[model samples]
Target chain A: MSALFGRSRSVLSRLVGALVVVLGVVTLTFFLARVVSPDPTNLYVSPQADQATRDQVRAMMGLDKPVLEQYVTYLGQLVRGDLGTSFSTGQPVRDDLLSRLPATLELATYSLIIGTLVGVVVGIVGAVRRGGILDHTGRFVTVAGLALPQFFVGLMLLWIFFVVLGIAPGPVGRLPVGLVDPPQTTGFVVIDALLSGQWAVAGAALQQLALPLITLAFAIFAPIARTVRTAMLEALDADYVRTATAMGLPQRTIHYRYALKNVLLPVLTMLAGVIGFAFSGAVLVEGVFAWPGIGQYALDAIQQSDFAAIQGFVLYAAVLYVVVYLLLDLLYARVDPRVRL
Target chain B: MSVALAEGNLLDVVDYRGGFRGPDGEVTEVLAGVSFGLRRSTLTAVVGETGSGKSLTALSVLGVQPRGFVRTGGRMLFDGEDLFAGGPRSFERVRGNRISLVFQDARAALNPVFTVGHQLIDVCRAHRRLGRKEAEQVVLDMLERVRIPDPLRRMRQYPHEFSGGMAQRVMLAMALVSEPELLVLDEPTTGLDVTIQADIMDLLVELISSSGLTACLITHDLGVVAQTCQDVVVMRSGTVREIATCEELFTAPRDEYTRDLLAASRLVEAR
Candidate 1:
């Protein structure tokens, strides 16, 4: 009972720490955007516009107050769940982000699933076969995956699959412009279509997702596979594995059951880091494919000097990373009983 | 002890030669023609210095030498059955079912991710072909036999939760769960406190005497041999320097190396 209480207390403390971190990130981004960028009024109106019009636009957007007062007002609005309006979109930042989140999530979810599966399988095979030809190839692929930049890989994949071979769909948005999207129940076209049994729409959505998914998965699998291979090599050589071998357990049992369980903690840690990398890399991959996700939204915001949209995006990302790290901690406690203590 | 030897050996390791092959294809022989025998129903101690191949010979009994170690020549006979005659696969039935090994670092030898009960249950299922409930029962009983304070509570605990002495007992429980005929212990108490080492040695002696099981103890400590072992095999530099009944080894040492080792141990003990 005390252990249970202790565990809950630890989780609560971790959540409090995460909130503090998110708050720090928000304040730092707010100040940094103000310090580095030009006056919002210049971008909001125009160079040709008179000073009176620019001042009116700044006052309308609540930028006429002192910087500290504006910051206090921003935090006050955030407490009431208002993210202000995006100058570029002419809509609430919250609404714009909520509408686009599903697209980014769908792409990220698929890419992470494919990347983790391939990385783990490749890692296990490479570790088990050690000096074999397949292991050498896997090693080379992982090194290359880590070395090449995400955008270059994205463009190259697009060139090969879409432009050169003509085997893939064009770098258009989520669906072809004319196709009627399924009813916006989930905001994710593929899932919504699947739910409503719209097979062709679903197929089209998946077809559009394929190349961008490949680009992100390819770039993110390297660290996962590398960490797994290293952990597995050490696990296979551990004394416990030797004990299992000496106990007349079959080689397969020793490898998969004994050695694999020990590899899980390290793999999970690496996956947490890889998940963060993939989300950031999705920004680049999404731009290349022109997928209408938050990455493209934020990219536009950055280009237009939309401070409110940028701040909102950073806040969402910080919360997401905190949640992911929290999940990883829970998984750690699950995999290793010692962690529960 | 001589009478037990006359009844016949339980395990006979004859002219075993093993080594590691480097990347350049040269062999570094770590065990050179090492020969020893364990008589039935006796506690034999293989005492030697650090690099004397005592642990290697113990590992060789189960055909589980570390990776890169090539056994160029060896014929291990257990109950008149050749263990290495059919190559590595030949020991599949004999290891853990008939012969069990308890390693030097007891905590490290137990899987960290699994509960003590889970790991022992696996051993039971693998060797005895028992179902889950039966294997679990055997594990609980075996844990009790090893004198653990609370077998039921300890069963659910991971290896790291146990202290050095308790972990060694857990390792002993794992080794004895299968009721093997031959139990090989490799420096089982080397890293333990002196009082804990004596306690473990006492538990081992009691277990052996009560069950009449054949056993081998691999250690560098002569005092442990003098206290508990029935026979002694003193090794030096990958070769057996002397093999004798415990009484003879202490009172009538033959090899100069053995005498030197005895004197060295005596000096340490006197200090």
Candidate 2:
């Protein structure tokens, strides 16, 4: 009974706690966006504009008021789902985010799925064959993979696949610049193309996505795979494993049913955190591949000092992290009933 | 003990030697020329201090010394057949079917995520030709045989929900669910308090003796040896220092180390 109530209570507390966190992130980013050089008015007005035009533009955005007043107004606007307008694109921030978000979401989701599967399988093999050549080589590869920066890896992949081999599609964007995209029903070309039976468009989009997805997977896979290996190694050394082995239970039973069950909580926690890091890596990867995902959009916004766009990006990222964490905590409770208490 | 030794021995480990090699290839001996035998349907205790490799001696009988530990030379004859003579498949047949092992920490031996009942059912069905429902029934019956109350409710509860005594009872039930001929208990009551330990030991002795099951009890507690075992094997530094009837060992210990152990045991009991 407590486990049932405890599950709901835990989720409620986590969600409520995330509200405070989100508020903090909003307030901090809001103030920081104002304080940072490259004023919002500078982006708005022409260099040759008079002071009157500059003051008028500032007043129009409610930027002439006190910092605290501006913050309050921003919060009020946020409650109404208004992230203000992008200085560069002159579009509502929320709509822009909603449109761009699916691309980053699709990329990160696929990469995480691929990364987690590859990591867990290799991690298990490495751990079960501990101290062997496979384990040693896996350790070396994971260490090198983790140590290398995501941008450098993305650039290398792009260079090899595009410049050296000429097998990959050009890094211009998701689809060929002149080719008509399938439809904007999903905002994601792959999904929209598949839904409309536009196989050619889907194939081309995937071809463009292939390298970035691989790069993102590699970026996330190192941490997740290493964690699985280390956790599995420790779990195999646990007393229960020895007991199972002594019971003459088959190796698969001991490895999968017993050791894997125990190792999954830590692995899940690490896995949940990796998606955030992977999405962040998407920013650089998107730039290298010229993929117009939220990451690239956010980068362009940052470069242009598009305050509203930056706020939405930061807020979107924070919410994603909180949701992932909450989902993982629920998974933890599901796996180990003790967590419910 | 002598009667069964003169007859067909249940298990005979002759001149067993084993050691582990480090990554640097340095060999450190854990068990050196240890030999003992288990009489069919009799309970025996292997008593030793820490680092004595008494537990290793028991493991070697099952052909499962820890990894990286090589068998220097040995023969483990179980039921007239050499266990090491055949491959792991041979041991696999014996394990959980012919011989079962219960460890020191019962809670630690059970997987944390699984209910005691769930694990017991798996252990029951692993070796036996039983469906899930039949296996569950066998587990419930075994839990009762170990004298655990509320077998139905307890089955649905995780290891953390069990008391130390309850957990050991569950361990015993799991070990005995498959009806193995030989039970190897590795300090089965080491983590429990004195009262719970005594209760667990009492339950174990009652179960093993009534069923006429042969068992090897590996423990540092002389009290366990004094109360539960019919025969005793005193181990020191990886070798069997003495093997005798429980009466003979307590009454007339020959080795100086055995005498010292007895003195220490008596002092602990006095405290």
Best by DockQ: 1
Q: List the residue pairs that clash in candidate 2.
A: none
lDDT of 2 by residue, B165-186 (tens): 8888888888898889999998
Candidate 2 chain A least-lDDT 10 residues: A275-284
Candidate 1, residues A1-341, lDDT tens digits: the string is 99789989999999999899999998999899889874767775668999899888888877788999989998999889998899888999999998888888788888999999999999999999999998999999999999998889989988998899988899897897788889988777899999999999999988898898988888768888898899999999999999988887778888998899999999998888778756643688888889888888888888888888999998888888888899999899999977862
> What are the DockQ scores of the candidates, in order?
0.74, 0.62
lDDT of 2 by residue, A87-149 (tens): 788899988887777778778888999989988887988999998999988888889779998
| lDDT score of residue B94 within candidate 1 | 82
Instruction: Show how many residue pairs clash in every candidate, following the order shown.
Output: 0, 0
Count of clashes in candidate 1: 0
TM-score computed on alpha carbons, candidate 1: 0.95
Fraction of native Cα-Cα interface contacts (under 8 Å, chains A and B) also present in model 1? 0.74
Runs in model 2 with CA error above 4 Å? Answer: A1-7, A46-48, A279-281, B1-6, B267-271
